[model samples]
Target: MLELQDAFARKFHYLRLSVTDVCNFRCQYCLPDGYRPDGRKSFLTLDEIRHITRAFAAMGTNKVRITGGEPSMRRDFTDIIEAVASTPGIRKVATTTNGYRMAERVADWRSAGLDAINVSLDSLDPRMFHQITGQNRFHEVMAGIDAAFTAGFEQVKVNTVLMRGLNDGELGEFLAWIKSSPIQLRFIELMQTGEMDELFERHHVRGAAIKEKLLEAGWQQRVRAHNDGPAEVFWHADYVGEIGLIMPYAQDFCASCNRLRVSALGKLHLCLFGEYGVDLRDLLQSPGQQAALQRRLREALADKKATHFLHQGHSGMTPHLASIGG
Candidate 1:
């Protein structure tokens, strides 16, 4: 099988495929105003998704993370999971969600072949969670976590966007909670997009501080897997859970780039902060376009920059994270 290698020899093995761009939550950092239709209502069909997954799998991609404004918002989310998981060469099927429907649907999702799950739980405090996500479903989301474990997931990952005055002071609380739960609490640094400049300035917290605290507390950093996401995982001897730091602003953050993103609209994003995308929907119209789609993917990869210039303040065509399933 051909590998999706960039100019720097970074072989891409993971694909972040967005099943839909619509989400129900009104998260402050992402879609504070809530999701407004951009006139493009329908996303790629199930058949289109299947074709893309097969092409990527043929190119040595094994992991597919279904993201969105919130992936489970789609009615056929379980079917989507089944489609990707059944694809040959695909070893893992995961999704990142806000956990709204997780309590009721995760068991079904697990049955449909989803093995890994990541939930966005910004704050343990209900009030704080409501303040951050603009949703009062804090208790419901927590229930979803419990449901995930009951549904056979040994470890559940919780994504917490690190913000200065928001949930920054709750690290101790998070650590305490993780001490007894099999959770991987991930601290993601706040990133600046085309919009949310004010929010970004007010809340953006450096991930290095979290790393320092973890190291001082005797948490050892673990080696990354060949197809792992961009999180520096750390383990503690006394804790039942682990901590992962996703510091995108770090100088060497993109050094181990191994994933590619495809939007719900069927456009290929070489980088999260990339300026534009290569349209793959036209090729996705039929299954016979597989060879062309693979060739196009390879050709487009040659244009991928060695690293994203996000630190230079170039967000590049990305109005927000939800638009491309960040």
Candidate 2:
């Protein structure tokens, strides 16, 4: 069996595959001000996604995340999940969505053998949430949260981007709710990816403050044996759920970074903060090229950057978070 390892000795077992670049919401952080959908209209089909997953699985990729601008927004998303979940060497198939379409199809996705889910939720207040995401689908996202638990997903993570004076005011509310909820939460420090120079300066919240508040509130810090990704996980002594801090800028965790990202258009991105990418769609389209594609992918991993540059407008990352499935 083959395995994907980078120059820094990071064996890549996780694969984040973007299923679509189309999303319903127009979040200020993720998309550009007048972003249009005309770019990269081609999305992978269920069979195409399976082919890519199988190629990665053959190289010891056990966990595959079906991500997107909003994965559930895809018409054949459930089938895509079934395809990757059924792949031979893939042990886990998860998804990250905005939760608007998940309430209606959470059970169906779970039945298809999705191992986990992570919803991008920046606010709990309906009006505030609407303001942040540019849509009035807060109720749907809330319903989706309930549906995920009712449907029995063992790992459901809620991802919140901590921005000062924005959704950061809801940190206390999130911590309070997690005490009784059977789900995990993660606070990602505001990343200055793409063209968000002003946004980064105005609303950038330090992740350390959030962690300090949690510790002051009596949350015990314990290292878990297993982890899904880079976010440092912590548990509250009085809460039923755990919390994580993905401090990309303040606390760099790049030394242990072990993952690969494939854009919805089948481009292999080495780092989220870098502009370099290798085109794999051409390889997928050519049948009987699995061995060749595997070799090429392995070679591409050698170019993975050791760390991300977080300076506003200088990260070198060309695409926005939405396009890269953050």
Candidate 3:
């Protein structure tokens, strides 16, 4: 079977496919101004998504993560999940959401063949959650998590972006909540994107501090899976759940990259901070274009850099994480 291999010999088995760029949240770090329409073309159609997934599966891709400004915002979100899950070689179908309608809709998504889910829950405090996300649906989102386990999900991952003067002091609260909740709470280091440089400077917190605290309390790091995301997970004997840290600024951060990304606009992004992307929408118009799509993907891999230039303060074309489903 053929695999998508880059010049650095990194084999891509996971694909983060953004279905839409429309999000309703006004998270402080990502979209404090809320989602504004740039009037770009419509996102990939259902047929286009099917063709794209089939082409990727044919090239030995086994996992597909549906991402977006908020993927569930699409009326056809469940249909999209079913389409990817049914692909011949695709084995895992996952999505990242903000849990807006999760309480009311997760069971339906689970029934549609979604294998895993990651929710953006920045703060466990209801008032703090509101302050951070610019929304008052904190209780609703928490209930949505309960709905996930009730719907048969084994583990539900939560993404929390760590910041200095905001929710950074709640690490102990988070650890206590996950002690028996079966949640894989991930603490992501606040990254410097193009538009949020000022905010990044004001709130950026190093994940190493939290790591040190965990180590002092007896947390042990675990080996990462071949297709897992870039999280350094740690487990503790007293807790039923685990903790993961995503420190993008760490040296050799991209050395173990085994995934690729395709923006909702049908362009393939070689790196999250890549300068540009290659258009794949043209080849996704028909079923007969699979072979050509595979060839294009292979050609595009050669353009991926050995590592991103973020350490040098170059954010490339990414103005914000919501634009490309970061």
Candidate 4:
């Protein structure tokens, strides 16, 4: 079987496929004003996505994460989920969403074989959520959270981007909320990606500081034998769930990177902060081209950058996160 190995000898097992570059909420750090997509097809059809997944699964990929401006925005989102989940050799399939419309489909998604769900919820307060997301649907998102838990989905994570002078003041609230819930809360360092150059400088919060606050508040670090990704997870003695800090900019883990991103346009992105990728969409459009697609995938994987420029000097406004399925 084919296996994707980078120059650093890291094995790749995770793939994030962005089905759409359009989103409902306009989060400041993600899609600010003047942001535009590459004008590719609105999304990859179910068969196209399945073909791509089959190709990747042939190469030892066991995990697939469906990402989007919002995956639920698609009318046939559950069909996409089922197709991926049923792919051979794929052990798990998940999604990341804003959760504005997630409440209505929790049961459907779970039945469709969604292994997990990550919700982008920077602030719990209605005003703060609206100001940050350009939407007044905090209640709806909150309802979605409730519905997710109620639907019997075992793993639901909340991704909170740490932004100073924005939602930073809600750390205590976030911690308290997660303490009593089954959902894991992951605090992400505000990254200077997409149209977030100014926002990163103005609101970036060090991950160490967030960890310090958590430690001070009695959250103890649990040394795990294995970690899912970049996030360093922690937990309080009494809590059943975990709190994670994802500091890609502060801590360089590129040597151990095991994931690649497929954009809505069908380009394979090697790194989040990378400026280049291999176009797999056109390659897969023609029948009997799986061999060529696999060759291109291997070529791109072999040359994957050892590390991102964001960890070196300045992380100045990288590619749009929506397109890359952040």
The residue ranges of model 1 lying beyond 4 angstroms of the native Cα positions read none
What does candidate 4's lDDT look like per residue over 103-165, in tens digits?
899889999999888999999799999899888999999999889988888668999997899
Identify the leading candidate in terms of lDDT: 1
lDDT digits (tens) for residues 32-81 of candidate 2: 45346776378877766877898999998899998888888788888898
Off by over 4 Å in 3: none
On the 0 to 100 scale, the lDDT of residue 261 in model 1 is: 98
How well does candidate 2 match the true structure in TM-score terms?
A: 0.95
TM value for model 3: 0.99
- Cα deviation of 242 in candidate 1 (Å)? 0.1
As for candidate 3, its clashing pairs are: none
Tell me how far candidate 3 lies from the true structure as C-alpha RMSD in angstroms: 0.8
lDDT of 3 by residue, 49-118 (tens): 9999998889878999999999999999999999999999999999999998999999999999999999
TM-score against native, each model: 0.99, 0.95, 0.99, 0.93
**Candidate closer to the true structure by TM-score (higher is better), 1 or 2:** 1
156: Cα error in model 1, Å = 0.1
Evaluate model 1: give its TM-score: 0.99
- Candidate 4 collision pairs: none
Q: Put down candidate 1 lDDT per residue, 127-211, tens digits, no spaces.
A: 9999999999999999999999999999999999978898899999999999989999999999999998899988899899889
